[model samples]
Target chain A: MTSTTCREAMREAIREAMLADDRVFLMGEDVGAYGGCFAVSKGLLDEFGPDRIRDTPLSESAFVGAGIGAAIAGLRPIVEIMTVNFSLLALDQILNNAATLRHMSGGQVGVPLVIRMTTGGGRQLAAQHSHSLEGWYGHIPGITVLVPATVDDFRGMLAPALADPDPVLIFEHALLYNAEGELSAGSIPPIDRAVVRRSGRDVTIVTYGGSLAKCLVAADQLAGRGIDAEVIDLRSLRPLDDATLLDSVARTHRAVVVDEGWRSGSISAEVSARITEHAFFDLDAPVLRVCCAEVPLPYAKHLEDAALPSVERVVAAVDEVVNVRA
Target chain B: MTTVASPVPATLAPSDVELLRRMLLVRRFEERCAELYSASRIRGFLHLYIGEEAVAVGVGAALEDGDNVVATYREHGHALVRGVPAGAVMAEMFGKVEGCSRGRGGSMHLFSVDHRFYGGHGIVAGGLPVALGLALADRMRGVPRVTACFFGEGAVAEGEFHETMNLAALWTVPMLFCCENNLYAMGTALARSESDTDLTVKAASYGMPAWSVDGMDVIAVREATRRAALQARAGGGPVFLELRTYRFRAHSMYDPELYRSKDEVAVWRERDPIDAIARRLTGAALLDADALEALDAAAMEEVDAAVAFADAGTDEPLSDLTRHVYADRRGERGPEEERT
Candidate 1:
């Protein structure tokens, strides 16, 4: 196992995809000479040159639509929006063109494009740069939404996304770029399933993206408190792996969904609703959620931390569900 | 405004006659569509290309096979001129499974991949960026081809128009930006909507060669598009042609057209493109009154056959309603084959 940062792993993944297919190219603002907004594409410009590694102007709609057009014209383009907030500027193209073109064209055209954007709050980037809106994209039917929490997933998700023959949006947590983890040499995991990061019997702590690491820490903290919690990282958000989630909930009989997005109309709400819809009889306690406060993330470190989901919040949520039955 | 006598070719060529026939086809087909809409045979929004036939036909004459074309919602004329079968277009308007988009997209979303006609995009200024990318793809692949994008002058008021223009110019991609300036954008006149009225000046600001042509004259539009398209296809970067035209009909079936006056419409109608071309052809002794009548009958016959085909077309089954949302790539290959 090679220890690498999530940023390095992502850079390596893009580099590898470029090497694998001549049709694959990277386009975004500051991706080439600037080495990506988060330094995820450092040194790629020199390796791949400007033809493959392109730096675009701050025109998200144009470049994203261009990516869709290039995908239709038979090129695999990886369009990187600097942040999730800016994706709103191109939301028209994403929804009207990228998401609807295949069905609109009656399956004659499929957008094989990958759009990667930084998401979530923690480092005090303020309201505009730090909202977890992956759920909004997950609600879309035509595009696939992926949130790669681990270094391995950050490295592995691109290949499958590029090969999927439809538009795939990868939401990389801005806070997880510097997180270090072991890069396993195993085969890349399928982008359609969820995996149990840590197994337990007391309760299932469901989460994804930036919240996964916090959930893992909460599980360890819960273990010391004699409350064993199973941690499930929802790698894919749109096609939420219901089987994995329901099976774990069936055994545990309790769930605490943690998400960085707002509580109302969020992915956590969707997950909790799905659990109640299918596995309501098996649950001993109500499904709880540890989501961000319904406010724009502040710039202050303490306020930002308070707005986002934390390990303490996860631990407390699990305790609430675990104690309900005790 | 008075109609200026356009310089007609001394002798009409066979290609020029074909251009006039194609324009007549568009005019007749849309006239029949208006009647069908009134008869409740074709529902939903119908935007007629009544007086703007010269733009589509003249521009289409400049394009070759294998080149890409992206157009806006008022795209029946574009699709017909691009060689999408009249039956397919009519069936699409009828929302049948045999339509070009398999009845998925109605009047505003006709698509024909076989003809390389990308879409009939509903959003204003939406197709420009996509066209830029299409050209970018060909440029990256070292292929010499041009992607022609058709949008109304209203699209210039959109940010996408500016953004796409800059990107296409910066990338030096082969793109032909065809702006059909129909004097009014929906109900808003160009003067009321845009601060500066000259669209060619707006395009020229992006460092691309821009031209404005008399859209009512089919030969003028054809010559201008041919020059611009040849330059773009020869890797001369992007070129913009503002086809100065007018829509003689209301914007859509729903419009009362309170924005413009009947006198203005009558004035523009004096320079009717089909009538002008027919006059030129008759003056040159290429088309007699009987021959013109024959061409008109043939167009009506084709429209009749298309309407019949649409009438007999089948509706898509309810069971397959959710198909093509995402491509069904299941059972094709395992994830193992996708690994690097």
Candidate 2:
């Protein structure tokens, strides 16, 4: 095992994919000489040359659509939209073309394209850049949504995403880029399944992406208070891995969904609804949720922290669910 | 309407005769479609390419077999010329399993990978970027191929059009941007919409060769497309062709067409592309009245066959509704499996 940051792991994964396939090329704003806006693709320009590591104009719809087109025409294009905020500019292309092409064309064509974008908050980048809108993409059908929170996932998800016959969107949490973890030489986990990060029996804490760390920290805090919390990192958002979620909920008999997006009509809402619908009889109490405050993310550090789902908030949510019948 | 004298060649080649035949086929087919729509057979946004048949046929003539085509909703003529069978196109409008897109996409989204016809994109200016990508792929692979993108003048108002134009020129991808400027964008006239009605100027600002052609003149469009396609194939760069044309019918089946006058339509109709070509052919002693009648009869017969095919086509089963949302990856193991 080797210790590395999520950025490094992702950069390595991209390098490995490019090296393995001549068809795979990375294109986005500032991906080449500028290295990447987040510097995840720093040394790639020199290693792969400009053709493979292309820096595109700030035309998200055009480049994203082009990526879809190239993928249709037999090239595996990895399009990077700098952030989830910037990705809105290309939303039409992503929703209309990439997501709808295969079904729209009656299985004649499939967009085997991979789109990578930075998501989530905590950097004080303000409302435009800091909002975690990956949930919005998760609502879309036809595309797979993956959130790689751990270093292993950061290093692993790209290969499977690139290999999929349909379009796959990978949301790299902004906060986790600098966070370091051990990269094991073991087999990479499947991209579609959710993994249990910290197994416990008292309460189930469901979260993904940046919130996974907070949920884990909250789980540790709950352990000190004699409350065992099973932390589930929902790796894939769209597919939801209901079996894992339902199984954990059945075992624990309680649940708390932690999400960085707002509570209303969010992934947290979906998870809570699923647990209630499927595992209603298994519950000791009502399924609770810890989500971002329904407001634009503030630029101030304290305000941003208050707005987002924190370790304290997660712990409180778990405490509420665990102590419901007590 | 400003009438440009017919530039028909004195001695017509067999290929030239074939061009007239193709245009007649599109004309007759769409005429049948109008009848069918009136009778309530084909449904949902039937954007007829009645007056703009020459542009699709002309540009189609320049494209090689390996070339890719991305067209807008008013693309029956484009699809028919691109070699998507008349039956398939008709069945697509009929929402049949035998349709190009297997009844999933109705009139506005006909697609056939075999003919390299990308789509019948409903969104204005949506296909431009896709065309750029197709060409970009070919360029990266060092393949000599062109992607012909067709959109109406309305697409020029969209940001995607500008973005695509700049990228196509900047990347030097082999793309032919065929803008069918049919005077009005649905109801809004070109002058009312764009500050500058000159579209070629907008295209030229991107540092690419852009020009206007009499869209009613099929030969002019064909020659321009050939020249542009050659330049693109030779790695010169993208080229934009503003085919000055008009749609005789309403934008779609639902359009009342209250924007223009009957006189305006009549004036443009006097310079009808099909009639102009046929007249030129006759004047050159290439096609007599009897041969013209035969061509019309043949076109009508083909359209009749297409209608019969569409009428006999089957409806796709509801159980298979969820298929193709994500490609079925049950049998094949991707590269990741091998690596693991």
Candidate 3:
């Protein structure tokens, strides 16, 4: 086992995938000589050469759409869109082409494409650069959404994501790049299913991506206060491993969904609704949610911090659900 | 209306008669589609290629067997000329399971993986990048295949058009950007939409070879596409061809076509691609009046067969509505099996 930062893990994963298959190549805004916006692909261009590590123009729509085309042409292409905010420019291709190609072509064509984008708020990148809109992608049906919160997942998800027949979008938390964890030697995490990060029986905190770390911290704080919270890392966001979530909710009889996106139509709302619909009989209390305030993510550090779900906020929400009178 | 009359001076092939047959096929097929649309047999937004048959047939003739094609929503002609059976294209419009896309994509989204015809994207300029990527993939694999992307003049206004043009030129990918400039973008005229009217000039700004051709003449379109396709296949990088054509019908089944005058449509109709090719064949004594009638009759018979196929095809079951959302898990082991 070895300790690796999420950034290094991601770089390692890209390297491993390229090594495994000649068809795998990386293309994005600054993936080549500029390393990457976050340096996740720092040394890749030198190792793989230009054809494999393509440095594309600042045209997200073209490159992303081209990635879909390449995928259709039988190449596994990893397209980086710089950030989730920038991905809005390529929404036409993602929604109209990548997300619809398989079904639109009636299963004759499948775009085995993987798009990696930095997501979430915390780095003070402001309104344009910050905002967790991975949920918007999760709402899409023809694509798979994955959030690799750990070092193992950071290294693991890429290969399986590239191998999947349908398009896959991987949201890498911008802040998690620096976060470190231990990856067992040569181990990669599964792309599907939610893993129990922290097991408890009193309440279930469902979260994924960047929020997983905060939920774990909140779980620790709840434990100190005599509240046992089961933290579920929704590794696969689109399929929403209902089995793990429902099992956790059934055992705990209480739930709190933590999300960085606005709550109105967020993944948190979807999770809360699923629990209400499927596990209502097992629920001892109403499901509570801790989500980002329904305003554009601001630039101010403290305001941004207040806007996002914090450890205190998650703990408070968990307390509300756990302490509710039956 | 100002299509330059620079028909190539080189000798026209006897197979040129085949061009007339194919264009006649598209013309007859689309004419029947118009009648079917009025009869309410095929519903949805049906964009007919009535006056634009030459562009699809000409470009289709230039493309080799392995070359890729990405076209716009008004692509029944493109699909038919690119080797997608008229029966399948008609069945797609009929929304039957036997359609090329299994009826999932009606008229605007015809697709056939076997023919390498990527799709008939409904969104303007959406297919450009996909075409560029297909060429990029072929080039990377050391395959000498050209990807021909067909879009209307309306797509020029889209950011994807500019982005794709720049990337294709910058990367030197083997791509043919075939822009069928039919004078209008749905209801809006080209003069109203674009800042500069010359599309070839706009494309040339990206440093790729660009030119305009008489889209009303199949011969011109075929020659231009052949030149561009050869340039792309020879690793000469991406080239752009602006096929200056016009649509004789409404943009869709519902369009009133209030954008242009009937007189303007008449001037374009005088140079109808099929009429021009048939006239050429008759002048050469290779085709007579009776032969022309026979060809038209043959095309009508083909369209009838297509209608019969669509009429006989079934509707997809509701149980399979979500079948293609994600590919079915095949022999591949589950994710759990990968945990070491």
Residue lDDT tens for model 3, A166-220: 8899999999999999887765546778999999989999999999989988888
**Docking quality tier of model 1:** medium
Docking class of 2: medium
Native contacts retained, all candidates in order: 0.71, 0.72, 0.75
lDDT of 1 by residue, B1-340 (tens): 1122233433567558888789888999999999999998889889999999999998898898889999999999999999999999999888899999998988898899999999999999999999999999999998888899999999999999999999999999999999999989899999999988888778888999888889988888887788887888888899888888999999999999999999999999999999999998887778889988999999999999999999999999877777788877556533221210
lDDT of each: 0.91, 0.91, 0.89
Tell me model 2's lDDT, rounded to 2 decimals.
0.91
Query: Model 1: what is its DockQ?
Result: 0.57
Which regions of candidate 2 fall more than 4 Å away from where they truly are?
B1-11, B331-340
For model 3, report the TM-score of its A chain.
0.98
**Candidate 3: residue B104 Cα off by (Å):** 0.4
Error of 2 at B153 (Å): 0.9
Question: Candidate 1's residue-wise lDDT over A196-310, tens digit each?
Answer: 9999998999999998988998899889989899999999998788989999999999999999999999999999999999999999999999999999999999998888899
All candidates in order of DockQ, best leading? 3, 2, 1
Off-target runs (Cα >4 Å) in candidate 1 are B1-11, B330-340
